[model samples]
Target: MTVVNKLTRLLNITYPIIQGGMGNISDPNLAAAISNAGGLGTIGVGDLPINEAVYKVTEMLKQTSNPCCVNIPIAVHPNVSHIVQQMINLKVPVVSLSAGNPAPFISLLQQHKIIVICVIATVRQAKKAEKAGADIIVCEGYEAAGINAKNESTTMTLIPQVVQQVNIPVVAAGGIADGKGLAAALALGASGVQMGTRFIATKEAPYHKIYKQAIIQATDESTVIVGRRYNRIRRLIRSEYASKLLEIENKNDDPAIFFKQTTENYHKIGAFDGDIKNGFINGGQIAGLIEDCPSVYDLLETMTADAKQILKQSLEKLE
Candidate 1:
């Protein structure tokens, strides 16, 4: 039996699973792998130059004929217009905007007939995004890795609230790693689910072996939020570098100091180079649930199958 929803029909994918566009980690190979597996793959262009972003998208296009998405964190990238134009020029099928308002660029992307998905953390933001012409809303909760909203809403609370507030399809994000999580999101009225940390441990992901190992070895307490004191909340694996950053944050260090520690360079070193001592790795609370590295195909196939069985069992119990 196939599960279908607005999200699946909108993107024309076989599954409602979306690969979270992790900066530096969302490479062409990984994106193509997920897309080829009948899920939405996203290429994350976090603060990269417009030309580089175009090149990455171009490379992704060459890998798979399947539809892929390009994610633009509006707050970090300076030339938003240029990047949007590049996507339009390339005929990218979908675009996901995050970290800032989508009102300004929504119409431009819509004009090109590209499906626009806005990442929001609050009911107010979800409503605003819908009004601003977002084709879909990805309700990312605080349990997610990287920058999170100050309200710190969990996926359980945020997904249902956003679904109730918006008419558009709501894709649940954060703290979702398995078929059980997928079933829970569906129960909460989410049309689909997006995963970040869970995908990091996959074989197709370009992250270093050690980074994947860290996720597999993580426990419920192995991850912690580091930048809360500075108001730039981010969840990361508990490491010497992360611990040091937390210690400095507690001491009320300069914002610049904290900013330096959280730069993309550090992310590259830790995530790509496996330099855990000098760099930190970003992960979500769901990291604790990951046990092995599988190919994207195997992961998604098993997840969907498990979700079908679990949901079926749940319905029988209700009867």
Candidate 2:
């Protein structure tokens, strides 16, 4: 049998697995698919308005009676109050927060009885989230795709440290794509794992064909860190734009010009065309490990099976 924890029990899910709330990519269809496969699916509504956020939640619920979560990046979207209220009104069972504090909104949501999970990049932020009333803290590492903190910490060094500091359940993120990672995180005192890049590579994700192919073909050395000068570091697959960004950064180019050039192509290539070479391929180093694009069920099953095998092998050694 697969291991179960208090978090899994609380969320009424069979596995302590969750799909990370990735903006633009993690929508109702993708979120519902993850939940249907027995993991918590999170809808990222940071880019959407309050009305659209509510509609997205409603549509996700309609997809599966199984519970799902909605992630709100407080700093990027100022409609968190409305989003939280919408969650309460719509009765969303779980809500995850990133990029900002959830304190002011926590009480409001807790009053309606919502499970709150906060994404933290540092031990200090983890402690702050706990004090601010986060039910669970997700320690996202520097290896993760998307916007990572400037003072990025690797998951290997950060997970156990965050676990040691926070009394609440800690979910490990960044570069985790398979059962080996799941087992390692559990061993490090993490209750579960939250994965984004791995899921994006799956068939369920709404990424463009080019984007998915890029992930499939990528290796550890295929990605580069960009936008560090602006204090908003993101990991993207090494491409034309990525190379140019690095070149500009190395030249010590103007910050404003650098940001404009980098972001200008993000939507044109990634969002619209899915051109891997010129588009935004936000992904973790795990891109190197993912060789095939499997269905969500296949991936989850393999992870659970592998984790159980690892546990069994460890016990055999004890005997």
* CA lDDT of each prediction against the hidden true structure: 0.90, 0.83
* Model 2 steric clash pairs: none
lDDT of 2 at 53: 73
Q: TM-score of model 2 relative to the true fold?
A: 0.93
The worst-scoring run of ten residues by lDDT in candidate 2 lies at 263-272
Q: Relative to the unseen true structure, what is the C-alpha lDDT of residue 245 in candidate 2, on a scale of 0 to 100?
A: 73
Task: Give the best candidate by lDDT.
Answer: 1
lDDT of 2 by residue, 15-116 (tens): 778888776555788889889988999988866767777777888999988878989888877677777777888889999989987788877778888889
Instruction: Report lDDT (Cα) of residue 161, candidate 2.
Output: 96
C-alpha lDDT (0 to 100) for residue 197 of candidate 1: 93
Question: Which regions of candidate 1 are displaced past 4 Å?
Answer: none
